[model samples]
Structure formats: C-alpha cells, structure tokens
Target chain A: METNDKINQMNDDELNKIHSDSLGLNVPENYFFESKNRILNKVVTKEEPKTIPFYRKKTIWFAAATLTLFLGLTVCNKYAALDEQKIADQLTDSIAQIDNENGATAVSKNNFNNQIPNISLTAENDILVSSLFVEEKEVDQYITNCILEDM
Target chain B: MANESDFIDQLISETHRDNAFKKLLDLYQVRLYWHIRKLVITHENADDVLQNTFIRVYKSLANFSQQSSLYTWMYKIAYNESIRFLEQNKNKHSISIEDVNTKYLNCLLEDTFFEGDAMQLKLQTAVSELNYKQRQIFNMKYYDDLKFREIATILEMKEGTIKTLYYNAVKFIENNIEILPVKKGESVQNTENI
Candidate 1:
C-alpha cells in the first residue's frame, strides 16, 4: 500500500504537468448555437399559452345558457303570480263596486253571516247591520216561494 | 448579470423567466458541452446531453433549493444525464457498460469531429479502464478543473473520497500509458486485459 501511494504521488506530480485542457474532442461548427436554438424552441413551445377553440368551449356556454334559462323561467313565474294577484285585487274591487251599487244579495249576506261568530250584538254592530239594504222579511218570503216552486 | 440569488429569483419568476433562461443558456452552454463531451466522448452525444441538461434546468428552476450553487446543480444534472444516456445506449445494444465505452472509443477515430491523436487516444483508453465513479471524479477534476469540494458536491461524495479516487485514477492512467501506435481494432480486448 505504501509503494502504491508512492507511485500515485509520483504519477500526480507527473500528471500535473500534463493538462487535460484538450482531449482532441471537437464539435461541429456552430453546434452550441444550434443546440441552444433547438432547446429554446422546445421551451418556447411549452411556455406558449394553450388556446382552446370556440367550439371546444361548449361546456362553459352550455352552463351559462342553462343558468340564464333558469333565471328567466323563475322571473316569468314570479310575474305571472303577481298578475294573478293583481287580477284578484281588480275582481274584489269590482265586486265591492257592485255591492255598493245594487246592495247585498241573500247569498252574499249569508256568506258574510257564516264568516262571523255568534255574539250578542253591540249597539255599534246593530247600526252596521241595519245599514244593509236587504230586508230580512223579504229574504224569508223569497226563500218560502222558492221552496213552494220546488215542491 | 445580477448576483446568483437575484438570478435565481429571475429564473423562477414568470415575467422574467424566459429571458433569464436564455441568459443561463448563453452562459453555461459551451462549458457544459465540453464537460459532457469528455464523459460521453463524442460531439453528437455531448450535444444531446447538453441540450437535455439545459431543458431539465429550465423545467426544474422552481424547485432549485439554494443549498448548492447553481453551477454545481447544473453540473450534477449534466452528469446524471450523460450517465443515463450511456445506460440507455447500453441497454439498447444489449451490451455491458464497458463494451459501450469501448464501442464509442473505437468509433472515436472514425468520427469526423474527433481530432484526437494517438496520445489522446491512449489517455482516453486509460480513462475508460477506470471504474465509473473514478472516471467521473477524475474527468471533473482534471478536465473541468473543478475543485475537490465542488466535485464532492456534484458527485455527492466526501471530498477526501473524491481526492482518493482521482489520485488512484491518475496513477492507473500513468501506469497504463503504453503509447498506442495505432487505434486498436479487434485487439482492444487483449490490450485492455493487459
């Protein structure tokens, strides 16, 4: 081992003079320039933003259209409900006008009575009842005539 | 042009990355080409390995941990790529690694780009005789002129180990430097055994 070390040390001294600066390896002219250009081309290809064609954006457009359609349907349903409400309000107003002009029929009077609970009439409630145009005796005679006709 | 840290920042940043990488290629391409040439021993192979090395460097810049210098890191990648190329060629030809080296070396004289004389050929043969690690350590030290510390970092070996391997490789070359009058053809096996 000592002899080997001595030989190695000697070789080191000798080899120090003999540099490996050139091993007679030569490249083709412009090899580095060509290689760098090739590598840069590859890198540039990778770095460029990938563009999706308009046809390929189908899912995004599809989702947007569906959402718009859903919103439109929801708004239409809401307005339709409001129109129904407005028609109801108009019908109620018309009925109130008719009652104001022609007074209460027996059916409407009975419906109003059915809606109210039985209670001792206060003086104010008696006045409200007396203000109605319908007479109770006439309503009873009309009812008696309808029963006779049916018989 | 900036300090290495600033340069690394530019390399990892999106806006400045492409220009920084081009600068990197300009700075290291020739140096790396020669380094790889000494190992794989052909202009074509060196060109391939160098390009691959730079491409890897660009892709892996974001992951560059600053523990080692960028120079050391790039050398490590080039070394690995060269080894990988040699291994792939060996597998493709169904030959041993030594045979692969021999195959390339035999073709050296015929290669249009190889201008090596008999002495250089002798030296290359002596180098090829060294084991894989010793050959790598010796080449980096002798040709690339990297310090023992730098070689240790590149090869991930202890400095003392690299020194020892380099010395041994040199000794082997010195002992084996019988001047080859001509390139060995079929007799390469006999000469290597000697």
Candidate 2:
C-alpha cells in the first residue's frame, strides 16, 4: 500500500498499452480531420492580404475630420486674438496723437501770451482756437519748427 | 534531416508556404491535440488550443532558426499555447490556476468524451494533485514519452531539474494510487501503473 509496485516494475508492454490506448481520451468521429480543415481555413484566410477600401474606413475619416476641425478652430482663434490686439493698439495710438495735439495748442497759446503781453487778448485767443483745426501735416511741421526754434 | 530542412524552407517560402503548412497540420495536429487535451481536460478547450497552436506555428514559421528540430519547436508552441489558454481561463474566472484545473477536472467527470474507468479516474486525480509544473512534466514524460532532455529544452529547465521533478511526480502518483489486480478473464484496458 506504500507504493504502487506495478509502476515501479512496469515493463515496456504495459507502457505500450498506455501509449496505444489513448488514455481513454476520445474525440468525436473525424475530429482531427475536421480540425485540420478548420485550422487550414483560418490560416489561409489570415495569409491572404487584407485589403480594406479607404472609403470604407470610417475611423480614419473621423480622425482626419477631427484633426481638421481642431486645426481650423486653433488658427481662427489665433487670428481673432491678433486682430483684436491690432485694433486696440491702433486705438491707443490715435488717443496718444490727440493728446499730443491738445498739448501743442496749450503750449502755443502760453508762448503767444508771453510774447504778446500788450496785444488784444480776445482776438489772439480766437486765432489760437481756430489753429486747433489744422491738418495733421501742418501740425507736424509746426511742431518740428517749434522744436528747431527751441534748439 | 535534409527533407525536414527542405520542408522548413518551403514553409517559409511564400508560394509553397500554404501547402507546406497544410502538411505540417496533418503531421502534428493529432499529437498536439492530445497534448493540449490532457492539459485542458476537455475536448472543446483542446480544440481551441490546438487551432491556436497551429496558427502560431504558421505565422512564426519564418522565424524558425532551425536550431531545434521542427517537432520540438512545434511542441514548444503547443505547450506555450496550452499554458496561455489555461492562464486566460484562470484570469477570466478570477481564480488561481489550481482552481481552474479543479474546475476543469469537474467538467471532465461530466464530459462525454471521457471514458476512463475507476482506475483511470484515480490516476487522473493523482496526476491533478501534483503542482502545475510537475503535472506538465509527468504528463509529457509518462503519456507522451518525451525524453527528459527534450522536456528540459521545451520547458527551458535544466535536464537534472526536469528529472528530479519528474521522479518526484511519479513518486507522488505511485503513493496516492492503489493498484488493483486484473481479473483473469478481463482485458488490461486501463493504463499501466494505475
């Protein structure tokens, strides 16, 4: 009962019986044949080059569309931000120019009052106010002439 | 050897590969099926693993370095595929491999294809009782008659280790199983040593 004496001394004949008997493991009739065919069918199918039509690939189309939309939105957003910044900078320059013109008019009136203390003050003030409507080219020339005279 | 080399070349060649693969399936499918069947313990699982083994062999034919015999290479693939199938089932059921084997043993008891007698069933139970590696070595040695060196090569274990594990497994089965004498008139239908 300690050890199976048969296995210890089992001869080749007994071993062959084990090999030939298939260990009571049976398959359905013609199972191997059918299984071979099935395996072959699968292998052949796999071996054949798989060719999917480009038009039939929906995921690729979807990915491409998504990328295009993302890029389009990003480009539009960048340009929109740039345009807004440009308009703000233009408005800032315009306000700076208007301030400079007002400053020049005040400075010119002060200088004229100091130089012509005895002249009629009402008429001179009217002329100085009228000069405020001068074109930008004429004002630039006047500012340059004032700077040169001061130098 | 020359013939096998030629065959291997054909298996890797595009024009002749399909035909050569068909020949390979004819030669190895039954043997591989039985090997897988013993591991999985059910015809359906064996069938699935066998098909997968052949498919793997087909796909990997080009990488065959001819370092080992074609039989050995294919046997290795079949062995790995059976293990993979078992692992997948183990994971799917959220159970250990031992639990999966027990579940399969229960299935085998109810399987129509399993016609083992009481002695055969006892031997199977004893074999199942061994650890997984020991079980594999025992089956491949006892049932398939694979040499220790070949088993070592397939399992990537040292030959001495394979021998030790195999003898230990044999001892375990021998100690567990009871040997009944054959009746004078009855034929020896059960496996030897059972």
Candidate 3:
C-alpha cells in the first residue's frame, strides 16, 4: 500500500512510464559466483594495514635518504675519530727519532716549532713534550694540530 | 519477515551463525547489488560496495539489536558504504562531484551491465543532478519503495523533512528530465497541483 501510494504521485502516463521503467542496468552473468570468496578474502586480510608501496610513500623515501646520510656519518666518525690519537702519537715519535739522528736538540725543537705553528708543547728536550697526552694545555695543542691538519 | 527476530537470534548464536550468515548473504546480496548499482552507476563499483557492505554487516552483527528490520539495517550499511565509496573515489582521483557524476554516466554508457535506453539514461542523469541528500531520499522512496518513516529511521531525519525532500527531488527530476513523451492526442505541457 505504501509502495502504491508513492507510485500514485506520478499521475501522468509519460511520468508513470519513466518511473515504472527507471534504470535498466544489466546484471553480469555469474557475477555473484565469485564475489563471496573475493569479499571474504578482503575481510580476512583487512586487519593487516594495507601497506603503501615504498616508491609511492613520500615518508618512506624521506626515511631511506635520512638513514643513508646517518649511516655515512656514523662510518666516518668510527674510522676517522678513533684513529686520531694513535696517528698523532706515532707522528710525534717519528719526529723525535729524526731530531735525535741529527745530534741536535734545541735547534731541532726550534725548527719543529716553526714547522707546526699550531702545536705548542714546552720542553728543554722535545721528548718530554712528545711523551705528554692530556695535561690541559698539551691536549689543547694536540687538538689544534689535528684540526689544522684536517682543515 | 515476521520471524526476523528469530533470524537475528540465530545469527548472533555461535552454532547456527555461519549457516545463517551464508543464508543472509544469499538472500540480500542480489537485492543490495541492484540497490547500490542504481546509486554508484557501475557494475565494478557496485560489486565492490556490495562486498564491502556484506563485510561490514558480518562484522557489525553484534550491534544489530533488532532496532530496525534486518534488511533495513543492512540497507543502511549499504547506503553508507556506497556514499563512502563515492566520496573516497572523488577525493582519491581529485575530481569535483560534477566531474565524478560525468565519469559515472560515461561508465554507465560503456558498461556491459547497463542496458538502459535513452529515457533511462536521462532519468539517471536527472537523479545525478539532484542534491546528494535529495538523491538519497528519492532513491529510497522511489526505487526501493521504502516508507517515509523507514527512510526517516535509516536517514535519521524527520518524516516531514523526508516527505518535503522527496517531493522536492521529484520536482527537480521533473524539471531536469527531458525526453518527456506523450500520446498522439495529449499535450506536451503538464499541469498539476503540488
């Protein structure tokens, strides 16, 4: 009765015809046969968040670039900074040997001071200065020499 | 249909639930497919929304509560799911509603499942032009043949408001739908009281 009352609103035959034969969308053959599993599959997998492809995700691309730069910095720090003290000590020892071979102490020390303007370690014989490692002013001088060499 | 409360009871039960759900799908899927088809305007889209609707219905079984008829509750889900699909598609493709409607019409024309003639196409076009809420009112009232009270319940609108919206939608369709044909003696113009 409600359906009839609603249909009665279109009184004219042309209007009625249009209303009666609204849309003629064809249903596909066997369409229903496969849809059950298809829908069930989606429901089963719905709990897992659908992953946006890495290439498509802007965040993923940004993260990959950030990780690469971070790793490069880490490798540079490990290889470069850890070896600095050993390299500095070995260079000091080699220079002392060269000075001793020349049979000159004060003259060799003066020449060494001139060569490395940044390194300032006081010594009567250069050996005492070379043997030192982290007595405030000496460590500062070592750091300055390393920085100058790096620059 | 009167035994629907029993059906719901069985659906909520663990033992009879799976069989009852399969039965529910078999009964409602075809009806829902056509209902969604009229709104979404494509076989592929309707098929997708139908699946989604059933999936939602299955998940939301605990909430059924028999507040409305089973089909009506399911119908509400189908309605919401279809609209959500349309909105998502519109945003995903970066198209205006007008552009989206045009694309749907084009799809309707090309789809193998669309066997409508010119007038049918014109009716669909007119429906597409109505305000979205008005289209919802119109489809529920006209095609689905649902009562104003039921539609009001589904849409959560007042009955009077739904009546006004439906009338307004009918008038809108009347104005927008061309290809109004008449018999040999009848006049081209229509005269009537609202």
Indicate which candidate wins on lDDT.
Answer: 2
After superposing candidate 1 on the true structure, give the runs of residues whose Cα lies further than 4 Å from its correct spot.
Answer: A1-21, A45-151, B178-194
Give the residue spans of candidate 2 off by over 4 A. A1-22, A45-151, B179-194
User: Under CAPRI classification, how is model 2 graded?
Assistant: incorrect
Clashing pairs in 2: none
Give the per-residue lDDT digits (tens) of candidate 3, residues A52-145. 7759988888999888866775575456545664565566677888779987675454565456533322222245433433478877898999
Full-model lDDT, candidate 1? 0.72
True contacts kept of each: 0.57, 0.58, 0.53
Q: Score the docking of each candidate (DockQ).
A: 0.22, 0.22, 0.20
DockQ-superior candidate, 2 or 3 = 2
Per-residue lDDT tens digits of candidate 3, residues B10-93?
788877776677667666666677668767878888988999899999889988878788888999899899888888988998
Model 2's chain B TM-score? Answer: 0.88
Is model 3 an incorrect, acceptable, medium or high docking prediction?
A: incorrect
**What is candidate 2's CA lDDT for residue A128?**
58
Writing each residue's lDDT as its tens digit, candidate 2 over B40-82 gives 8888888999999998998898899988889888999999998
Q: Evaluated on chain B only, what are the TM-scores of all the candidate structures, in order?
A: 0.85, 0.88, 0.84
lDDT, candidate 2, A1-151, per-residue tens: 1132233224323443453353556788878679988998898755457799998899999999888966775575567656665765565566556658776544443344344334234455456555756888999999999999999
Q: Which stretches of candidate 3 lie over 4 Å from their true place?
A: A1-21, A36-151, B96-99, B178-194
